[model samples]
Target: MSGVDAFPGKGKVAHCDKEKFDLKKELARVTRERDILKKALGYFAKQKE
Candidate 1:
């Protein structure tokens, strides 16, 4: 039997070869922004004490 047919669930696999890299970059940028915002909020709260 051929390689494709050897794998039973191959037909169900979804391909996103083009957008995969962009998605990872976007996720990293969002995470960094969130961390920076949290630190700023903490600094402001401490100043009010």
Candidate 2:
């Protein structure tokens, strides 16, 4: 009924799903790096005190 359905066997939707997955993976990686940096900063701050 919509524009995507009219295209039949086209793979456009799959491409969108892959893009979404990539974004989620990138977000997770950034969060992990941020947590690691935070812990390192805390350790250094304690050493300075």
Model 1, 1-49: lDDT tens digits are 9987787763654467437867898999999999999999999999999
Residue 25 C-alpha lDDT in model 2: 100
Clashing pairs for model 1 are: none
| lDDT (CA) per prediction | 0.84, 0.92
Q: Model 2, range 1-49, lDDT digits (tens) per residue?
A: 9987887865556888889999999999999999999999999999999
| Candidate 2 Cα deviation (angstroms), residue 4 | 18
Worst 10 residues of 1 by lDDT: 9-18
| TM-score for each of the candidates | 0.63, 0.72
TM-score of 2: 0.72
Q: After superposition, how far is residue 39 of candidate 2 from its true place, in Å?
A: 0.4
In candidate 1, position 41 carries an lDDT of 100
What residue pairs are clashing in model 2?
none
